[model samples]
Target: MTPDEPRSRLADLGVGPGAFTRGRHNAITDVSGVLVGHSTVHTDRLHTGVTAIVPAELGAERRWLPAGLAVGNGYGKLVGATQLQELGAVETPVLLTSTLSVYRVADALLGHMLEQPGYERTTTLNPVVGETNDGFLSDIRSRPLGDAHVSEALTAAAGGRVAEGSVGAGAGTVALGFKGGIGTSSREVPVGDGRYTIGALVQSNFSGTLSIAGVPMPADELVSAPPAETVGNSCMIVVATDAPLDARQLTRCARRAIFALRGVGSDFSQGSGDYAIAFSVGNGMPPADATLSPLLHATLDAVEEALINSILMATTQVHADGNRAHAIPLAAVHSRLAAAGVI
Candidate 1:
């Protein structure tokens, strides 16, 4: 937000938007200890790839954490979620890719892990994978995701900057009649009795409907053209926190992401596959202990912040396919808000 914007143009915070509380960078990388990597593929016939999210304790091997998943729509494929849920732990990186390419990424992930000097020799590994449909701009039939791309994503995973819009798996994604791709945001809540941070990242390829805090606004009122149909859009949300929480508590945090999603006008359409995964650093909880109240509150604050961040800093991205999906154009959106006396 400190960056200067052209007087004639408004900044794109995410899918459909006007303004919300945003971090200094307004990106998922704003979350402490969260790293993001993108493998973008653009060729004569390819416009999709993968994104890897690493929530490690600065990439240390001994840093174990609790994790959980929530599947809003099961129409899409997700790998390793069962294990993550069963064990309440996520020891590996999470990869997001196009539909029909889950197995390829999973296998590549395994290989990537083994390639590490003491990978399997030290411990068994399990990778988390999530995806959405990209058949519109990509040759989804070709199954373009391969080992090289997956490996690149893993190797490139690092904390700091995260590229959004029309990159990685979002390169071929469409939302709300316009070109929609990746978006991210973060929120900070007082840790308790107060301390710690919670953040969120979203591979938002969901449908476009105009809604402001639950009130529907016709797309035409904002953008010149609205997407044709709102069907088949999907979104993948990932929440990461340094707070200590168990698997069940993490799952609850992941569900909060849907609330912010609805604020941005997502109806969780028929063809949409909305899924969330939440992970937390151990904080002060002992690995052997099964119950801790202080650690539990940390997770609740994280879930709340993570969901809000997913909707804040996402800017609109236009794809090469000639599709332009704009998150409520800032100017029109602000004007509409003022007219409705909501701003």
Candidate 2:
């Protein structure tokens, strides 16, 4: 499929009505004031880009948002992770890009924040940047990303439908033996007399047996085994919510997001860097422990759908060296799910 072709999401295929209701857009942007943008850098040999997640309170009236991190494998680079954990907050927009370009992206993000109207006297700032290796489909060692790409993404941030598949940092990613990219989903939960939204966004580039709704893809239908060189890769998950959850609660939400990978069949390989970063933009008193169950359940549902969407929405990509990663065959997948009565 061409990069511009419209892609289908898990919901469009009638995959679920999980424990909670989905937000209007069924995307992370469904969380109030959360915006997402992408800057794609696609060329013959350079198929990488950047994605920026800008929270509402990040600009002139900048206020640190409560945030938490959970590491599943800890084999990839996540800048500002320690500081985020230590202070239980995020002071800048989160950025995602290729592994080699992470440092450059981080520097650019730092610059972007420092230039904000209220930061004229800023001394120290922590910019959170996450990455997943895209070496197999891109010339990763060349480090193609630059400040311009970052600025483009940050400037384009918007709170509506998010563009998925082979765009942004997901441009050259591979997952479950198929073409992989960016994906997102959100859920709405009712607690006390109020309702909250939990959303998830994922950059899937790891290896695994493709599974959908508890049904695994037949071995014969596999898109050939994942290339040996790309076997142990990684996945980055970001969770956002408008729920009044504290840092500790957000950390729990992050862990639940990581566990959602099991439903999609990820093996969590030794070299895979699986991580989940969760942050809350809500205010007022946090919910009681008894009321937290629905939030956790919502986290699991949204994250699983987001992971699946990452694979389903991806288009086939060909590397400069002639190696290719094919998109999963939707027809076959549907048949499998039907045969198993999962649809």
On residues 246-323, what C-alpha lDDT tens digit does candidate 2 reach at each position?
999999999999999888988789899998999999998989878889899999999999999998898878777886
Query: Can you give the lDDT of residue 150 in candidate 2?
Result: 98
TM per candidate: 0.79, 0.96
TM-score of model number 1: 0.79
In the predicted model 2, the residue pairs found to clash are none
Determine which window of 10 residues in candidate 1 has minimal summed lDDT: 1-10
For candidate 2, the per-residue lDDT at 125 reads 94
Model 1 alpha-carbon drift over 4 Å, by segment: 1-22, 58-60, 122-124, 213-217, 226-231, 286-328, 341-343
* Model 1, span 1-343: residue lDDT tens: 0121221211242233222334455455666767888898866456688988876562345535788787887667778878888898887788899987878998898777667654546466777888888776667888989798987887787776566666776666665554456665554444444444566667766765645434455666555675533324777778876656678777767766655566566667777788888888646652323333433343333333333232223344333555334444455555665676665
All candidates: CA RMSD (Å)? 5.3, 1.8
Best by lDDT: 2
Candidate 2's C-alpha lDDT? 0.88
